[model samples]
Target: MPLGRLLLITVSLVASTGLASAQHDRADWDRQRARMVEAAIIEAGVTNQRVVSAMRATRRHEFVPLAQRRLAYQDMALPIGASQTISPPFVVAYMTEQLDPQPTDKVLEIGTGSGYQAAVLSPLVADVYTIEIVPSLGKRAAKTLSRLDYDNVHARVGDGYQGWPEAAPFDKIIVTCSPENPPPKLVEQLAEGGRMVIPLGERFQQNLCLMRKVNGELEREPLRATLFVPMTGAAEERREVLPDPERPAIVNGSFDEIADDEMEEPLPAGWHYLRQAEIDAKARPDDPAIAFKNDEPGLPSQALQGFPIDGRRVKRLRVGFAAKGEGIRFGQQASQWPYVVVSYYDERRVWLGDEVIGPLRGSFDWIERSEELPVPASAREAGLRIGLLGAVGKLWLDDVRIAPAGG
Candidate 1:
């Protein structure tokens, strides 16, 4: 055989292999994307078909950093540089559904971190005007949007507090970052009866609020509790609650101070993080309990709270709670079970490790569970998560408490 012919055939084989590999990856991404939408979005209670369709159409992997693409379809947030993160898939779908976007509506998005949210909105709304305070993030997002041919999204770098005045009177608005209160300019720019979904409250504790402008005034409705990076620039200066560590201990762990709004999910106060879990509506008046039900068919339900602990002062801690499970089953992975995890974090909120209790399953009556965990030398805070991690079942919890082990 001629050497040149042999070389050409070898190159052709390599090209075909590369093409097959790329196609295989694309197929895997598509499967993950479908599962994400079904469990994280649909089962998580985002019912708006428009939002669901938009979420299905958008390619989240494209907006994420190259290193994080493999995790793009997961229901958690991933870093996208500039010390920022792309919002979780569930959050993006929830917020977009709250906005009630329409085909002819114009949307203004604040805190365009990775442009994923804008890209999701692009197909649902007529136009999307997004602003990012960070120059680097803004430029990269703009480039990604353009590259993806999200022609309807208009990206710019500026203070979101000022909003896009030239594109005033947006029919819908969504703020990704949390502000202590709604920005005045954004309020003014909203057309009458326009809807806006934003995270509003203190630094670590905030609520996802859905507001509507009516009669030149904003009517606020708290949707659920969430935590987001605080809005910078002017909103930052106006922030009233500075970051401060709370005393180490559980608050409202007995589920006594639960929100009683029948219109919304019953949530317990002091539990800053909640997902698919709520205060038991069926509990007796004298006995309140936190309820964890698998609304997401096969997905895990979680409700957790994080607090600061002085590692230098406190050495070991004891956590106690009573739980009951019904028709519970572990998930496909070993880590998925009905358990309570105490996750430790450093001063910068980097996770150190976790101490867990229970793989509780099957129909069981109330069982008292307790565990004592040593504090990491570098730990500054810890999180208490109570739920079925990746498992599906109904669980009830009560009398959760945390204190110094020997105290």
Candidate 2:
């Protein structure tokens, strides 16, 4: 045989071998997905046949970071940059099962994170509207989901606290972040027979709570203990902050003591930094108010950290604050609010339980709200949480007062 002929034959053989190897690699990925569903999901008791099938079909590795692809099928959260993470596979399955999605259902997911949860729901439901607070994450995940041909999923970068009102009456809603309590707006958006699965509690300590809407009310049940990043934006801004219980009556409650230099991030002299939610008075980002960009999701940029009442003197307290909005737009005759919440904290500052005062309704006129806060027995200290509780708008605050109920 000629030398040239022999060389050509060797090259042809190598090409064929490479093609076969590529085919095998693709097959292996399918097997890995199958194994993940059976071992990480099905065996763990996620028995919605449709959910199990969706889990089996989704390319888990594709949704993960390049370096972490090998461990994608393993049951654990993976870092996807921007200080965000993808939830573990088992937890995802469990959460999905709890939602009990149907073929005709329209689901809303609060934390878009990696879009894995949305991807999982895409096939099981008719449509999925997912909101991610982190803009970069939302954009990236949307791109990935689109590229992977997830046409049924819709993605947006905004605060999930207000829920998607325009797309109100969702058949089901799922929140990945833990809020102090369920956001009132989300509950209002749930359909007559809808279900919402969310994690409720403090930053480090939280529970995966499930709530079902029946006859215009919520039937809540905490399913399990889970660790999730606290909900950011408005929900985060509204979280309870335990100040030194003995701190005097009201210092800088009038928003007058606000640091002039950092008006955009105005901190009234005595208030503590609980979360970095941007509060603005007017359109100026530098002005001060308990504000939120209605169109955006994630943690608020600034919030007024409240003063804690000494649980020692009395478990309950009286709280009041003045509030108004500048650019807040309410939903179709539906009321939104800026309110105060007083919650108890143990000696270590762990959350015991809380009671909401008034979600002072949104209005142009500065309204003064005063209410009694009933503290639970677990109270060593109680924090006065003040901020807006609505979809999108600018809320202004002045003259916040906290006192022992007896006084």
Best by lDDT: 1
Query: How well is each residue in 1-407 modelled by candidate 2, as lDDT tens digits?
Result: 99999999999999999999989977998998887787668755678898888898888888888877888887655667665678878788889999999999999999898989999999998999999999988999999999999999999999999889998889999998878998999999999989999977655445566799998999977665465666889998998942355542555555545434423334444443223334345523343444444433222222334334455666557778767665554433344444466656565445567677654444577666788767665565444555554335656666678776767
Steric overlap count per candidate: 0, 21
**Candidate 1's residue-wise lDDT over 107-133, tens digit each?**
999999999999999989899999999
Runs in model 2 deviating more than 4 A are: 1-19, 241-407
TM-scores for the candidates = 0.89, 0.57
Q: Give the least accurate 10-residue stretch of model 1, judged by summed lDDT.
A: 241-250
Using TM-score as the measure, which candidate wins? 1
Q: In candidate 1, which residue pairs clash? A: none
Please state the error at residue 233 of candidate 2 in Å.
1.2
List where candidate 1 sits over 4 angstroms from the true fold: 249-251, 260-263, 270-276, 281-285, 295-297, 308-318, 344-352, 374-382, 403-407
